[model samples]
Each structure stands twice: as structure tokens, then as C-alpha cells.
Target: MNIKKTSVLLTIILISINAFCQQEVSLSSKLKSDKIKAVNRSISLFGDKEDAVEMNAEDESGIGIIEDVEFEKGLIEIELLGENNPGKSFIGIAFNIQNDETYEAIYFRPFNFVAKEQIRKEHMVQYIYHPEFTWRKLRKEKTGEFENEIKMPPNPDDWFKAIIHVEETTVKVFVNDLSEPVLIVDRLTKPLSKKIGIWTGFGSSGRFRNLILKE
Candidate 1:
């Protein structure tokens, strides 16, 4: 092949490889892909769901502790903590928000860099206290489908920061500030929609300190 042609082919090959090996994101920064949407841009403060809370519980328990949280503009924050309360494993919190509809999924982004091995399982299911979202006996997922897991930080109890970026089909998570999200569950390629408050998973009863959904 001519030198110019050869150079062009090499460039194409490099780009293709980079695109595959390259990650969707490296941190809690902007999303370059068309699928990613920056929904949690703003945060609005509102009333509280004034309710004493505890740890996760058995399924069929109707919102053991419901907090009346409120918000306004954009980003919504759901704060949950065991807070010095040891032996608090299996506790879960349901984030009910008011906004445009969006997909249902969860993930954790440890340092925002998701190792290849992490994408095999569903992180949202395991990390999220709510297993009913797709539990067969619980009968939650209507489609009877499954997707890849969105990895969480190394340790769930560890004091690491994470962000759940919700768009259409894809949910991107960032760990420790914006480091290529520990994992990107689904790369949404569909239209936009609104997502109400996050549902409290079944068999989980945890305390939610702060919950808000911006309008």
C-alpha cells in the first residue's frame, strides 16, 4: 500500500482499538458519549420525610420508614448511613423522588475505573439493598431480562464518594470523585424520560437521611 494509504489504515486501526479499550468515562466529569446525560446538575432543598428509621427488613414490608423529601431544579441527593451503628448489614433505603421518568438500575464507581472483570455481574442488584427489582420470586422485573452490573467502590462501608448518573438506558456511576466510573451498566441509546423517586428494594429496611428530587 502507498505510504499515505498505509498511514490512514494504521490510524483507523489505532482508533478502533482505542475505542474498544478506551473507557466511557474516567471520573465524575462530563460524559463524551451521546448516551450519557448529566441529569444531577442541580440540587434543591425541601421538606423531610420525618420518620425514625432502622436497617433493612424482609420483603413485603411496605416502606418501613418513609421520608417526605423535596427538591426543585435538577440534581437529587439521597443520603443513607449506618452511622456508627455496627452489625447493620442488609439495610436498605428507598429513594422516592418527583421528576421525569428514567430507567431503573444502579451501580458503584470505585475511582470511576471499572475493571473488565467487574462488568460480568449486576452491581446494582447486589450493591442495592433492593433485590426485588429483578427478583424472580419477588416478581419485579416485568420484562424478565438482565443486564451487566455496575461495580461499586471497593468497600460499601468505606468513606468513598460515588455518583449515580441516570440517563436513558445507561446508568453511569463515578467513584471517588470522577474516575471513569467503576462501571457503566447500560449505554443508553434511546429517548429521554423522567424517573420518579428510587424504589426501596424488597427485603430491605434502611434509614435514608436526605432524599430529594429536583424538578
Candidate 2:
């Protein structure tokens, strides 16, 4: 082969390898038998014959906890899409998950981020330590401490990227902006090291993709 042709072929090969390395492994392939148990109705996975998981429970919340992946102190990034109707969607991630009913979660109220009412805007993002510091209790006791308004809200119906950084006792959430964090918690309610999973609330449906965890 000519020298120029060989050089071009080598560059193309390197680019192809890099792209394959960055391609996210579908969460659907990591689900375990007991990891994801539908509460009220069955959850659905859709993406080229089902490559992504969607929360579709009607009466109660649905979840798909990834098995064997224990996230301690690192970064978690994912793309999420929620319903656009006001007060209709709750989509987020749960970390330090001890079990099905216990975990620390940070989710977005997409419908509330740009609502007409001020109160709704105040509830754009939420943090909860399940079975204890639920959003209601935290709001009542600590008021404006657990939840914060998203400074730059993204469209509810469109897909948005969420980047979560978890350190020993602190957890910071950044949405679409790497330089500035949208929410920061000095102390996390749950332990620092635990399993991680996707979360949805009652009457909410969401889709997730490109879930990557760095430990």
C-alpha cells in the first residue's frame, strides 16, 4: 500500500475504536431477576428491540435497579426524558440504594421547573432519603434545604443530561452544565457507598439512556 493510504487507514481504525469504547452499555442487559420488580404494572424496555428501560407503573412507582454495580464515590451520568404536563412527571436517580424501599434519590420535577406558579418553580429539583427524609418531611423540617430550583431548566418533554458527583459525605448534581452545579448537599442522608438505580414516582413515566458510572 502507498504511504498516504496506510496513514489514512490507521487514523480511521483509531477513530472507530474510540467510538466503540465510548458507546454506553444498555442497562437492559444488566438487569437481574430480583433487581427490577414491578410494583403495580410491568415496566417496559424499548430501544432497537429494547435497549432502554422505561418506568410505566400507574398506581405506584416503578424502578430498575442495576445488579452487581456498587457505586461509591465517583460520577454518574445519564440522559433522561419525562412527561411535560405540569405536576405529572418525576424522574431521577437513586444512589446508596440499600434495598427496594430504602435509598437516597435526586430526581427532577420537569413539569415544575418552568411552571406559571412560583411554588411550582421552587420544586423543580428534589432530594430524598427514603423511609425518613422524604421531600415532604425535609421541606417541612429543613425548608428549602433538601430541594432547590433548577437555575437553568431544560424542556420537560425533551431529553436532558444529568451528571451526579458523589464524594464521601457530599453529593452534587449538575444538569447540562459542567462548570456550575445545580444542587449541592453538604451531607447525604444515606451512607456513602451503596448500589445505584433509576427512580420514578407515582403517576410518572420516564425514559433513560446512556447510563455511565465511573468509580
Candidate 3:
């Protein structure tokens, strides 16, 4: 091709790449939000690891993925890269409770009996909001309060599948091959405080290759 034609081709390629990079992220996509949806400010999570981060394994290994979105009902399918390590011992996603800048809700695993079976506290969605591109935890709470807030949703130590069912008044979580979830949270009747994030407990980690949210 002539020099002018080659230059034109390169320019077209550059524009195509730029347009592709600027595409908006969907609630179910692997890409995290570039900025906060509400405040419209940039939020930086730990070392490029936002609450909703996308990770990939070269050929199926110990890696897992996290995501952030707002879905009422959907099938979030997680694929395991490490097939040899069957029975997985444990692996799955996590969702932290937040109120604007603080997380008042505790992090107890919904099925873990270690935590007291008590009423899930209420959250205000009006002023409160979940992190879209970032996550923040409360720091002023007492020792005991901190323990309660950080409780992993059911089986924090062990891996389990979770289905988030948001109702008119509560959010129910179904875990590990069980038809019923051990924990049923009375969701805040107000609007959604913030976007939901995906979590994979420490030690027991894996990547989410696909997340299909369908009502």
C-alpha cells in the first residue's frame, strides 16, 4: 500500500482502539467502573484491586475473580481454572455491606454457626451507598463490633456458591449446593444504598471468568 493509504489505515486503527476503550461498563461485565457512579470521583482500591476486579488464569489455576454491580436476580456462573484441585475445599464470591463511606453491617458468613443467629441490622439507601469502583470499611468501632462487622457471609473460611435474592424487604443468600440459604437479611426498604461488590475470601481464592445476571 502507498504511504498515504498506510497512514490512513493506522489512523483508523487508532480511532477504533480508542472507541473500544471508552465503552461504558455494564453491571454484569468483568470491567470495573472507572469512576464512582454517584459522586463521579475516582476511587482507588488496594493496588489496582478494586472491590470488583477482573483476573484471569493462563490455563485454569488457583485464581478467582471479583465483580461489582446491581442485580436483583441473575445466574452468576463461576468457572474454576484449577480442575485438578477438585472438591475445591472452598471458593466463591463476597459482598461487603456499606453505608456511604462506612460499612455498618457486619461480615458474618450467612451459614457459619460461629456467629450468633441474630437479626440483620437495617441500612439506609437514601444517603448511604455502596462503592462502585472502591470499597471502604469502618474503623471507629470497638473490638467486638469490628469482629461482628467483618463476619464473612456464611462459610467465610470454606468456599461456597452464593445466590443473591433481593426482595422487597430482604436479601436472601443461598450457598453451596443448598436449595435454601442459611441467612436471610431483611434488606433496607429504602432504595439500594450502593452497588454490590464481589469478594473471595483470603487463602481460598479463585477467578470469575463469567458472570451472567438474568432476571
Candidate 4:
């Protein structure tokens, strides 16, 4: 082949490879402004794209649901970073989300993981059914059923991976470690398949990237 022809072929191949690697949906494009307060910012996790959805909510109820995606039974893997501070920072995913007001969520209170008090550690991971079954209600009614402490905790300030597996009535959450789930809920509040979203609690700011939904 001629030198020019060879160079052209190489460029084409590189472009194709780059396009394939960046095919994963970006969070910024999936979420709407009214659903959750967010802004586009550069994320190191996604090499092909420079923008990731940064959830900036003054209230804990802010949620960014992915548009046009129906999540029934599958796995959701994403990278999340909670605000690093002494106060509680709720950062996680909500699946089976019917709307902003309704969904089941698995969130992490990073500050609690390394708290001086043992009670705080117990509330490290939480599973809540919005508008009905909250962490407080569940803890009071069903102890040790909805929330639990992480066996292996990650840094609050650093980015960590959260893997969520949902099938019918069962939902399991794995943080950092894929082998064992940190928290499991056998009886899901909303059993049917619904939209998925990235959630942030009141007074919380989070960064999300590489949102992949597999069914």
C-alpha cells in the first residue's frame, strides 16, 4: 500500500475504536433539568466525553432519572463521588423509579462509615422506598433489614464504583467489592421495572460518570 493510503486507514481504525469505547450513555444527556439540578463537568472516568452530570442539589430529595430507559431486571454499574465532609452525604442510585417522588434507592452515607460513633457506622448503607418506606421507618419496624454497615468501606472524598443488581422482588448492592453485596433487600417496594436515576440527598453534591445499564 502507498504511504498516504496506509496513514488514512490507520486514522479510520483509530476513529472507530474511539467511537466504540465512548458509546456508553452520558448522565448529562439522560437527565432533565427539572427532575434534578445538575451541570456538565469534565470527568476522568469517561475518556471519550468531557462532560459528566454533577448533581448539585440543596435538598436531599434531588434525583436525576434516565430518560427513555426501562429498567426491569439487570445490573447497573456507575462511578460516584460524594461530597467530602463531616456531615452526611447521601449518594447512590434509585431503580424501579416511577417518577421523582417514587422509587427504591440504595445510598451511602460516606461520612458515617468512619465516624467516631459506632451508631453512625451502622447507618453507612441505606435502602429506602420513597414516600412510603424510609430508612427511619424501616429501621424502627424492621431492624437490620433495610440498612447495614459496610464490611469494606471506601473513602468518602474519592470516587468509588457501585454495582446494583435487581431481579423481581430482590435487590442487592455492592460497593467497591463485587463478590459480596454490602446491602440486600429481598422484598422490593416497587417490584415492576421502571426508570433508573442517580440520587442525591438534601444538602448533598455528587459527581456521576460511566452510567451503564444492562438487562
Candidate 5:
């Protein structure tokens, strides 16, 4: 091929590669008020392993939605710390959030992380689609399908990593550096919105850091 044609071909190849490769987006940069939309939660920015955000709520659920992120199918990973407050510590990531009332989430029950009872152990991690399928509903009807027992649970009082891989039809959650996913479930709701968030359950306070999205 001629030099001009070869140059154009090379440029096209580069653009195609960039489009399909994973692009890491740092969510810590959107700490400003104009960028985050909080629902029934109070958020504060601080420094830990890196720049982090802490969320607290006394009643109802709390979620701090990153306003500009429009994630459909991608990977969301973050370091989260929750106390062993038995039934109070629900810390995890929320995505495809249409609003405060509706969304899909995969949260951890840190209180159940190292439970002695078999039932509690099974409830360590959960996936829920609000306004329809909640933890209570899924547990009652579907039984042990939506939630899973973490074979290697993390410490409740310390920082642990939660990596969630969201896909068109399914979601997989890996705790810490585990090669195998602790929880895997089919996607319940369709693509509602592009919003993604950090969530904490009632009476729970969570510290989050190293929030990243690969798309």
C-alpha cells in the first residue's frame, strides 16, 4: 500500500483498540457537591488509603450517587469498611440507579461476615432490585438464590475490597482478592439509568475508598 493509505490504516487500528480497551475512571475526583447527589444520606470526604468518602444514615437507606457516571455494563470496584453492628452494617455498591426508590445493588452484610450460624453465613452478601425484589422478598420467596455464603469472609471492622462485574444479563461479585466470585446472580431489572452509587443501609455508617470503574 502507499504511505498515505498505510498511515490511515494505522490510525484506524489505534482508534479501534482504544475503543474496546478498558478505561479506568476514578470516582474520587467527583467529590464536589455539584457532582454527587445524596439521597437520605450524609456524605463526607476524607483521606484513607487514598481520597475517600464516608456515608452515614440513621433511618432509611442512604446512597451517594455520582451524578455524571453513566455505567451500563462495566466493572465497579471499591474498598469499603463497615462495623460489626449485627444487622446494621450493609455496605456495597449500587448501579443502574433510576432514582432513590429504584435501582439494583450488591451489598455486603459485614455483620454476617464471620457468623457462627449457618443461616447468617449464607446472608453475607446479597443482590437486590428495589421497589420489587428486596433482600426480604428474595430471601422469603427465592430462598438462597440471590444471596450467597462467602467461603472466605473479610473482617467486619476493617477495610475490604468489593469488586462487582456488571453485565447485560448477570452480575458477579468478588470479595478481596478471591479468584472466584462469592456472589453471582442474574440481572433482575433492565437498564434503568446510567447512575452508579455508594450505598449504606439503615443505622449504618460506611467508609469507602479507591472507587474505580472500568468500561
Candidate 6:
């Protein structure tokens, strides 16, 4: 074989090796105080369920950062449940956390999953980078670029699966078993931190389970 062809074969082998070596960690094994760090929120193992944690925000938004885990990329799959509380009910995953105030988050407005109005339906899922590039700012500036409607949305008042694929510059979110992502947006920040978390928005409460992080 020529030198160029040999180099291409070596590159493919290395890529496959790296992908196989990535670890899959289950973060929902326990919801004890030593396992999770709640930021501006309160969390406890859901009384009615096993292997799940419920989160309630104290102010605007709250995060439950998984202790000792640092995830930068790959795939994240979790089950989230929120209510159909109209203006409330924002729940999803957060990663690349720089601090309590600065981080990247992708959350859902469960109430808007099946809204009667077309505009409300379009606002079902959102992507935002905090301290700047907020939902309000993105909506006003980038318009439909950062958020989109979910096709075949799950029940707003019950448990639904979220699969998030994160790359260096892009993020894709899939709801339930959808073949295509419901929301895909170019990442707004250069991911520098390794923090991964579960998030809830203003006056919101959320339940999360089966948290799996593959990296």
C-alpha cells in the first residue's frame, strides 16, 4: 500500500480505539448528599421512585452537579419528568459548567410540548449559555436558531427520555426514540470546564433518573 493509504488506515484504527475506550458512567445510582451537589436548589431521592432524584429551584434556576464526574463531550441520556405548569416546567441537562452563574444548558418547556398555538409549540426546547446568550437574548437576537419544536413530543406531565449528543462546537437533543434531533444548535461557548449537571428553571421542579454519561 502507498504511504497515504497506510496513514488513513492508521487514523481509522485510532478513532475506533478511542471510541471503544470511552467509559459509560451511571450517575443515578444514588442521590445522597455525598453524591450530588445542589446549587441554589434542593434535591432528594424521589420517594415514589427508585434511582431518581427530584429537584426544586430556590430562585431563578437550580442545578444538581454530579459529584466527582467531569464530562466534556460524547452522549448523555437521562429520563426527565416535568409538569404542564404553563410558564414553569423547564428541566434538562447542563454541561461545561464554569460556575454557578456561567454554564451551557439545554432544557425543555414541557407545557409547550403540545401547545395549541404554533408559536408556543416552537418554543418547546431551548439551548442557552449563561451570563450571556440567554434564552431571552437568543430569542430576540438569533430568533429560531437556538430553539425548536419537538416532533412526537412525550407526555408533558410524565417521564420522557432525553438523549443529548455533544461535540466540540455543536449539540443535538433527541426526545424519546426520535431518529432525528429535535433541537440542534452550534455551541455558544468554548467548553473549558468538565462539570456536568441536571437543571431546572424558575419556579420549576423536575425528576431525573437513569442518568447515563458516555465519554
Candidate whose lDDT is highest? 6
Q: How accurate is candidate 4 locally (lDDT)?
A: 0.73
Model 6, range 76-179, lDDT digits (tens) per residue? 88899999889879999999999998999999999998799989999999999997988999999999999999878888998999999999999999999899
TM-score: which is higher, 2 or 6?
Answer: 6
Each prediction's Cα lDDT score?
0.34, 0.77, 0.33, 0.73, 0.86, 0.88
Q: Give the lDDT ranking, best first.
A: 6, 5, 2, 4, 1, 3
The runs of at least 3 residues in candidate 4 whose Cα sits more than 4 Å from the true structure, single-residue gaps closed, are: 1-23, 31-51
Candidate 6 residue spans exceeding 4 A from truth:
1-30
Clashing pairs in 6: none
Better of 1 and 4 by lDDT: 4
**Tens-digit lDDT track for model 3 on 56-149?**
2222212211234543333333322211232222233332333333221212222233334343211100111123321123222221222222
Per-residue lDDT tens digits for candidate 1, residues 1-215, read 89999999999998887565422221111111222221322212122433222333444322321122222123333443322222222222222222322233342222222334543233233222233243343224432233234443344443333345545455444444545754444432332323223233334333433333323
Report lDDT (Cα) of residue 116, candidate 3: 49
Q: Give the residue spans of candidate 5 off by over 4 A.
A: 1-28
Q: TM-score per candidate, in order?
A: 0.38, 0.81, 0.35, 0.77, 0.87, 0.87
Ranking by TM-score: 6, 5, 2, 4, 1, 3
TM-score quality measure for candidate 2 = 0.81
* Between candidates 3 and 4, the lDDT winner: 4
Candidate 2 residue-wise lDDT, 1-215, digit = tens: 99999999999998887665443546776543445544444556756674577877475655567666667677888999886776569899888877677778889999886687777787888888876778889989988887788777998888889998878788898998657888887655647456778888878888887888765
Better of 5 and 6 by lDDT: 6
Model 6 quality (TM-score): 0.87
Q: Which pairs in model 2 have colliding backbones?
A: none
lDDT: worst 10-residue window of model 3: 120-129
Which prediction has more favorable lDDT, 4 or 5? 5
